[model samples]
Target chain A: MADVVKFDEHPSDTLRAGANFNLAGIDPASTPGYSGDKGAGESLLSELDGKLTQLQEQLFAESRTGGKKRVLLVLQAMDTAGKGGIVNHVMGQMNPQGVQFKAFKAPTPEEQSYDFLWRIEKEVPAAGMVGVFDRSHYEDVLIHRVHRWADAVELDRRYRAINEFEARQTAAGTKIIKVMLHISRDEQQQRLLARLEDPSKRWKYSGNDLKERAFWDDYMDAYQAAFERTSSEHAPWHVIPANKKWYARIAVQQLLLDALNGLALQWPVPEIDVDMERELVRRS
Target chain B: MADVVKFDEHPSDTLRAGANFNLAGIDPASTPGYSGDKGAGESLLSELDGKLTQLQEQLFAESRTGGKKRVLLVLQAMDTAGKGGIVNHVMGQMNPQGVQFKAFKAPTPEEQSYDFLWRIEKEVPAAGMVGVFDRSHYEDVLIHRVHRWADAVELDRRYRAINEFEARQTAAGTKIIKVMLHISRDEQQQRLLARLEDPSKRWKYSGNDLKERAFWDDYMDAYQAAFERTSSEHAPWHVIPANKKWYARIAVQQLLLDALNGLALQWPVPEIDVDMERELVRRS
Candidate 1:
């Protein structure tokens, strides 16, 4: 019943695709597909929660019966673009048992010794799971390009490697939902200041965060380059305007809903004889 | 404010410790500690959600600054006793980013090759995480003892190994909450029947479940033996009456809240110069 509640515009279509996409054209504060105000958005989200939970359970059940299909949500964003908020509000609504969440930090010495995707390959969600990457293999291209850690040839090679990697995942029954949470520099400053002002939030503030703010333009360019190279038909990037935290949360929730719905998931058939089991249970 | 709302008796005290514990003495249908009716209990649980979320966030924040304190909830129960429900309703309320959930099944050949504690040690909560085990190393004792897979000597060795492993974890600042969700045989039958009749829930039913039910008394004995030998000051086993799903959920939530509250967690001091960072953010 909740799935019948429709948006004026489907976020999946409006938000998807990165080819010839311009970062400046999108407004971070706008709610694109959702028509309602904050209260309605929140209400619809609560309604959608039940549907999402059921779909996820079906997926997990399917996995138990040798279903290989799973979902991987790849989140790439700058500092304070509300990636954690999305994880908390959207992905957090699902059963934690069915969700595999991994936050990738800078590579360690051992990780640096291997290809960038080696550590990532280790954390992929198994059959019937919804895997979430807080910051994923995209960083190898985004951050590396910003700092010129790799030459154009190597950067280009990394982009090809990423596309190939994602294609392989899609071929193996993984539906990859790649998202870029787009937030403005002004919004980042405001968020950072809020973190600095509140003692409870101060722990999140760091000197490096401010230092990173100085490279705002360079990071934007890096993101655009990465998008142009890696976004493909199998795994298109969805640029979510994340300045309004509520809007971003709802939009991402919609994207996940669509992904799960696209799977047309149904509960797996019971492997046992129901009549015999029922009789046995009754006698016992 | 929610924490100020008190139970008639603290579940932490009422349900804790297994010394001379009688599994049959506790009524599965009775609501222990909580004095409220179902409606009131559900309301109180909704209220407690905020408190639990804040406490978990503080634990996670502490970990960012080298705080080693963490909590591990180990849930063990019979089939259809609601281990998954507790995880969905209780642990599901917290941010998934801070919750580490692992469900143990029959060990694979690789897992069986290692010491029983080896697989468990790998899944322990890192600093500032709330780790949950759906079923854990206790299976080595419970299932093994019930089926006579191991003799008295090996079972005794395993109990000691589990105790020592938990002691080391506590020494390293992990607070372990071990819970056994106790349900009546009649309740399990009703639950299995409901699963058998509902097509949506049929995937959860297996013929093996009915087979396991025949050994109910043996499983009970094995559980009691596990509690006597393994429960300790650092890691105590709390047997929760789970016939009423609401009571079991809130009682477990209270146990987790008490564990986190006992830690006396505080937000870590900001490592950067606050005024300087604020001014820099303003400039940016």
Candidate 2:
């Protein structure tokens, strides 16, 4: 049996709410809280699966019984930082009924006409759901900042808007988990090259990805600014070094596990009289 | 290694659209088209996982590149018939990004105000996606007939409306797989009792389930009426005997596999200049 990995300090604590956090300072290949090789990390993830499923079901049960709590996992990452992999391998473990997934692409004509958060607010998870945003409202700040689509004043205004938006959601009982899957520029190049070489993966590649690569430093600066501005006690930002796919997967899973664990979810008490219902079933 | 299970006649063929179909005549406990025991059936399901994943990814890739084809799995069943089990065990194996899951409850006031298909139309799978409906528009006819909520004329109109709705979706490139998970009344009684006995599963139990159980024969008739009127060549209904949970799971998995296989999906060819992009990526 693989020894259960325990962390004296939670992965969330190590990764969350950086005051003077430097995105460039973290090594993309490092596994922060896990003391394991790839094999051990993979085994640990399999172990976490059962616990995650149970917690999610309990959360979903709460929803059915008029619980308002929900979780939003905001995943902001560079291309090939394994956002899709995390969604498939991690969120996919739970009942898909309880998972609402939306991948926000560039704004359409109608979408651009509305506030950035307009399209986002429409997709918020209902009571007792885990909503996964592949790329989110953060993009308005990140890409828009790097490309100078919005002036500095407008960009600064977005930061406040985001803070207020998240605060409002938090007040409404949304547990927000914001993560930046940190990857080195070199790692992205290798992964892009791999996609280019493999015909099956070529659908994910675009010349626009390379064009964006030229703005790497600008993107990083924008991310740093966004993190400093938006990281709050209610919703904090966790920067996971994601050069190693296995580590990123487990680390993100652990962050979600920590969040659900904090909810102290009880199986909602049976609302119906069990004895009476059982008798009726038996008679039927 | 588990030997791959090959069916000379697909499970879809054995379980689909019947002119003389009798729901009561079919044995709920029978595992049609599958000659394996529970262990073997499970092993075969595991084997089907990789192929399903690959096919779903190809379908999703097609969606990304402007392919409009999609699949919708419509599941209608009596309470405790393992519809949730099939979703958790089978559909959960695919990428959540590509799977749109909706569990329709009794229509709310807003939903009731519109034509039944209005709510359902809004949830249809986009291009290259698989949409699963736990209980669907069929309920308007089933429960309405059982409870006398609608007169015979209204029910007849609903049948025509359903047929036209499905035909329109089919013409719009939606491959519809309609299924009824048939379970014996005895099996349902046992399952409901089991839920009542297990504290952890009590949330899934309800007093209303027993009330519905009292109307078993009427429901079977409603289901029979539905299968007859709405089973079209473009969209056929398949009734699977679901007494054995393992068999139902693998049977549903196989049905999905057959639908995807019929598509004969090819990997979407890369739209970008591969050589130029590769050079750019290498330089970056």
Candidate 3:
């Protein structure tokens, strides 16, 4: 189960979104592919942390030395689903040099005037980078659909555009991992209440979260439809059970590790005389 | 000395640029504002780390709760001067939510068409956030002048324009900390050679870095001139001796801690009814 957790490239357990997947079919609280004691979770994650960190550095180093490959971890989730925590805890373990994190808030008036992907294209991680999008172009389909902001024809055009975009990135030495953190409505309500209760966390609370919560059913429907339309061979969507924040974090890291390791990454070949450089550093 | 380092807000020690400051004036081997054992440095930083972490989290919390103030930490240096290391070590310690790190590489054709600061203005840390620029607008004067890309009059205009731009941000509730990590020419050569020797670091080696190094003296002259014209009470330029990378990291963190502490920040008042929320969470 542990090896399967680390080595499973297909993400079959959570890759439900595109393959006749149903949002209602998956249990958010259940931990997939692992039946370990909950107390052992942190230690399990720490082990993965070490391996992933090394691979990430190598990915960065390889990219520096003419490795064209890069990875983009596209994260989309509802409020209180722990997107920030995943960034801080999972992506944080990697060196910031190699990680390009862009948090997509509401579109600025300037951004709104451009095509939806205009801002996104500017922010994609460069070669040898592990780029993370806190929210991404997916926002167009999710919120735009929930709010009836897009007409059916325009929405279809966006779906086609997204597929082509990801395909282009894939062909250009990019590996795309799109994940939607799946959390139960009950768990979200509990988390929101918890945030409000703590003085420090109260600041994280937003009235907008509540306003959006009222449209929970509609958002879920939108997500289900989005994955079916946009998910493809190049960049498939994985809906992780997120009520257990640990599971979501661990699973996400495993997915990333698998992606990096799959590249058969090699350290760059030396261009200068190592012995001479060592002597110079020693003298300096 | 430690307290002095933490409290020194003038930035005059490292701000030696223009006609007044010389690249030869300071010792890269020396640890300015610190007298402690080099081995004990991490422990000392660990001590300051606690205070700064709390303050950063509070700044983030406060911002989320409607605090208008934010921080912009601008980092500039020649190649291999450890700009990325500072971001990974110093800024990485803070919560990623509150830290916006942007590495500005050579301008794209699109970026070149617009004025330089347009891209920079877009990336300024939002309210209650801490912004770190890996290489910034200074590149325009530093590289553009070194290469004679801009004529003398145009360079002078860019200096005034940058000053006005930062002054505007200062008036708008942003605390700007502009830092230049200074390394000696000998040290830079040693570091460059070391990168060439190490396969993992080879990818980080850009042929362009060598191209820039060939014009080192011109770049230094450009930097001195820039500081003379642009350093102000609003956004003072700081030059930390970076050969001892740890000392540089600690000092930069100290500068940031000092900036955040100076805000006299308060945790935002509770918006939701605390007791009611507590009761609700307890019920859930």
Candidate 4:
């Protein structure tokens, strides 16, 4: 039987017996997601490409008219939960122009001094641009919850702050897309061990990462609380099962397409008529 | 004959007396670009899908293995040069997990105090994340030059800071990809007019945009100077023609593929053998 995991439950630090088991009907090699119906789980790689292309064209039209729309994508997940893979694979399909990727790291002295959202707001997408944040402002809740760095009152205040901040963005006509990549502990161990074994990848493995891995239960609890408090209709969280990378990417593509499709954009045609074209041609 | 316009000249600002001339072997419908090469001038739409898939797979591998390569995309361009379109269209191809897009707009009060690069530094890609900066620190050179916001000494100081900043990033294993979208003055006028006619795009059309358009020469001078100073082996600029949006996207896509192909990463394999898998399956 598949290991049923809930966000609220404490994470198991050790690899559990059933944690590695694939869900029924899930193929490790094939995509691992279903839309509304199981039978409709068709290959969307092509459709994703087509939809993205159309969206790009629509957005391109917007930019040509200088009416650019900003897109902010936020990805929050647990350690070894395929956040990295999801970023790599999912964004591999984007055109470099319309997209600007900003990964917010540990706050420098300057960043820490200001509000946490200061650094994040700086990286928000400009008009007609898409911005993705690998780990976003929610860190106050996630890391703070696990480490107890912030008191309950402070944390509560932050939760409200985040909701208000995102709401402001939504009002500003910015599209907010958030995803949480979820992976099993057993799968994570397999990945961690693989990184240790490979010389090239060994550089990525740090003792600190392992140390954090030991506190998986605390982190999971933090994540659960953060998600419960933060998830909303304005910024719905897509809990992606990331053991399968292809499916996660396809799902993201679909989500983006759905959002972009709602925009209802028209391409600009040159204002010149047949007579104008002829006259311009004749003059030329 | 094609007008011999200088860098400082805007396509709209210059009114040329000429017949509608279609250069031989040039497909007007094809994305407009002067690669100076006779072949492979197709727009981004033609090749966007294929490259998106290839990159997605690579990103998945890198993310799964916890590789720490960060991809930073920098786009610079004149007004209506398709920067927004490029961001929208190009990013349409990649996975969201690995990519985070940032557009640097007018700095806030807090941002203005520090060096211009300070806000940008905070948004740099983390290990294994892709960061895109739209109208990034280069604005110090581009906009500052046109507006004369910085005296010669301050501008000179800013240039050195930028060079050092990018070099340090490259040394620290950041891959910086810079693209400049080039659009003609005629094309700019056509696009601007479209924005004025469209109510939805009116929000993006500012009186200043028109005023800025009038100072095309100054902007070009600023851009040329900026490009010459900052284009380096570590972060070379690929000048993309923006007349054909499709072509611009294609050029950027090719650049991404080339950069990623250089990494040559392998997907991690499970250490457990088939027998172990079978046993695990049976146990489950």
lDDT string for model 4 (B117-183, tens) is 8999998986666677788999888778888899899988988899999999988767888877777
Off by over 4 Å in 4: A1-284, B1-68, B263-284
Candidate 4 RMSD to the correct structure: 11.1
Order the candidates by lDDT, highest first — what do you get? 2, 1, 3, 4
What are the Cα lDDT values of the candidates?
0.90, 0.90, 0.81, 0.63
**Which lDDT tens digits does candidate 3 get at residues A102-181?**
88999999999999989989988889899999999999999999999998898999999999889988998999999999
Candidate scoring better on DockQ of 3 and 4: 3
Residue pairs with colliding backbones in model 1 are: none
Tell me the spans in candidate 2 whose CA falls farther than 4 Å from its real position.
A1-8, B1-8
Q: Tell me which of candidates 2 and 3 scores higher on TM-score.
A: 2
Total clashing residue pairs per candidate? 0, 0, 2, 46
lDDT per residue for candidate 2 within B243-273, as digits (tens), equals: 9998888889988998998988888887778
Predicted candidate 3 versus true structure: per-residue lDDT over B1-284, tens digit per residue:
23222323333444434346565577767776676555556666667766776788888777766778888988998889988888877876676667777889889999989998989999888887888888899989999999899999999899999999999999998999888888988899888877876666776765667667778789888877888888887888887888988888888887898799899987677667766655654554
TM-score for each model: 0.97, 0.98, 0.82, 0.56
1 against 4, candidate with superior lDDT = 1
Ranking by TM-score: 2, 1, 3, 4
Give the lowest summed-lDDT range of ten residues in model 3 chain B.
Answer: B1-10
Against the native chain B, each candidate's TM-score is 0.97, 0.97, 0.91, 0.80
